[model samples]
Target: MFVHLTSAANAPRIRRSGIRAAGRGVRGVHCFPVLPSYTLTHQWVRELARFGTRGGLVAVHFRLDDAEPVTVRHYGTPGERTTAAEAAGRLAAMEDPRGWEVFLPRSVAAPEVHRLRRPPQVAGWRYFPGAHGRRPCQCDGCRVRGEYGGRRLRERLPHPLDGPPPPTRVLLARLAAAGDPGDSAVLLDLLHWFGLRRRRRGPVAELARLAGHPDPQVRRRLVETVWRWSSPGAAELLDRLADDPHAQVREAVADAREWLAETD
Candidate 1:
C-alpha cells in the first residue's frame, strides 16, 4: 500500500507475510502489507527496469481487492522494453483512482521547464487586481514571492511606491515608510512576510511605529515586531523601550518586556 519507488535496486520481493518497510527515498521504497489485497505479479513489472536510470522517475504502489493503493511513474528509455502489453497498459491506467494523465512534456530545450510547471503562485500581486484575491495564489506572501522571477516580489515593493501594492497592505506600508538602514532591511523582510507572529491589527501598529526608529536595525525590528505581534500596547511600548541608547535597542526592549511577561 502506498508505494512510490523511483529505483532502489528495483525493489519488490515481498510475498505478503505482514510485509512492512515504511519509508525510504532518494528513489523509492514504502511498504505496508497486512494483506487482504495484492497483485503486482509478473515478478513486479520485470523488477521495474532494474532500478530505473536513464531519466529516472519511477513509482509503484499495490493493492487490488481490499483496494486503495495504486501509483505509477516510470519514464522509460534506460534499456527500454517495459512491455507485458506496456505493463498491462500502465496497470489499467493506474486502476483509475484518478491517476495517470501527467502532461507538460513539450520542450524547446527546457524553457525553464515551462516555468517549472506553472509556479509563481503570486506575490506582490503578480499581474495585479488583488492578484485574484480571496487569499488567491495561495498567499504565504504569495508563496514566498512565487519562488523568484518576481525577485522577492520586486524586493517587497513600497520603495517609492508606484506599482504592485496589495501584497499584505503594500508590505505593511513599506514597513512604515522605511527611512533607511538600507530601508530597514527591506523593512525586516516586510515584517517577516506579514505573519508577524499571528499579527494583531495592521502590521502590529506598523511595528509599534518602528519603536522610534533611527535604525538600531530599525530599533531591533521594532522590538522584534513587538515581541511577535503581542501588539496591543506591547507592554506599554516595552516600557518606553527601557530608555534605549541602543544597547541593541536596550536589549530589544528588555526582550519585549520578557516576552509580554511570559505571554501574560
Candidate 2:
C-alpha cells in the first residue's frame, strides 16, 4: 500500500478516475509507501501544500503488488531499485523518512484504492528535514521554478552561475533527428521525451525506422513508445517488436502490450 498526497480540489476527479497523471507530460505519481508511522507515510502533505493547493490537501491510499518495480530514494539523491514491498519495509524501518520517497511509474486504478482519508492537518516538514534556521538554497537546480512563490524567489535569490537556459525541446529534437547510429544516449533521451507526451500522429512513422536499429535498447524503447501510441501503425509495430531476440526487449514488448490493452 502507498499514500499519495494532493490538493483536496483534485479529490473528486481522483475518486472518479483513480489517481492518473494530471497531464501527458507528467512522468508518473510520487508517493510514499505506507509506513508504520502515519505521519511518515503522509510526510509530503505539508511540503506539497507550500506550493499552493487551492483547497488544502487529502491523502489517497492505494495498493501495489509486492513484486511491482519501483524506485526509492532520498530527495535530491539517486534512487535504488526495489520491489514495492521492499520499498515499504525499507521506509518503515527508518527513524526519519521525511525526504525519502517512492516513485511509482504508472497510474493507480480505482479498484486499487484502499481509502481516501484526511491526514493530520500539520504533518511533515516545510523544507528539507533538519533544515531549520539555514539559508534555503536559491540555485535554479534547488528551487522549483513553477511553484507558488517561484517567480519572487527567483528574483530575490538569483545565482551568478545560473546563466541563460538552453531551449530543451528544440535541441532534443535536433539531436534526435541527427540519428547517429552510435548515439544511444540521445536516442534514450528522445525515447523518454516521447513517452512524456501522447501523440496520435507523426511519431510512429519516424520511430518505425528504428525497428531495425542494431541496439536492442533502441528497439526496446521503440516498443515502449508504441505502448502508449494511439495510431494505426502501433499494433503492427508491436507485432514486429514481439520477436526481439533480447530477453529484456521481449519483456518490454510484453509490458507495453499490457499497457496498450489497459489504456485501450
* TM-score (all chains, Cα) for each model: 0.21, 0.52
Which candidate has the top score in TM-score? 2
lDDT of 1 by residue, 1-264 (tens): 223333432323222221233421222223222112233321132233333344332334443233223233432312222322343355454533121221111111211111111111111122222334443243334433334334554555433422433577677557556653446667667755554335564445546666676767766666665555444776677677778788987887776666667668
lDDT tens readout by residue for model 2, 1-264: 889988888888888889985434336778888777777777777788777776788999998999998889998898898999999888888877789998887888888888898887679887878776786777644777677777776678776545443354664565567665647777766665665454664357767777777888888887876676667788788888888788878899888767666677
What local lDDT score does residue 235 receive in model 1, on the 0 to 100 scale?
63
Candidate 1, which segments miss by more than 4 Å at Cα?
A: 5-56, 62-264
Worst 10 residues of 1 by lDDT: 110-119
What lDDT score goes with residue 235 in model 2? 77
Please state the error at residue 230 of candidate 1 in Å: 16
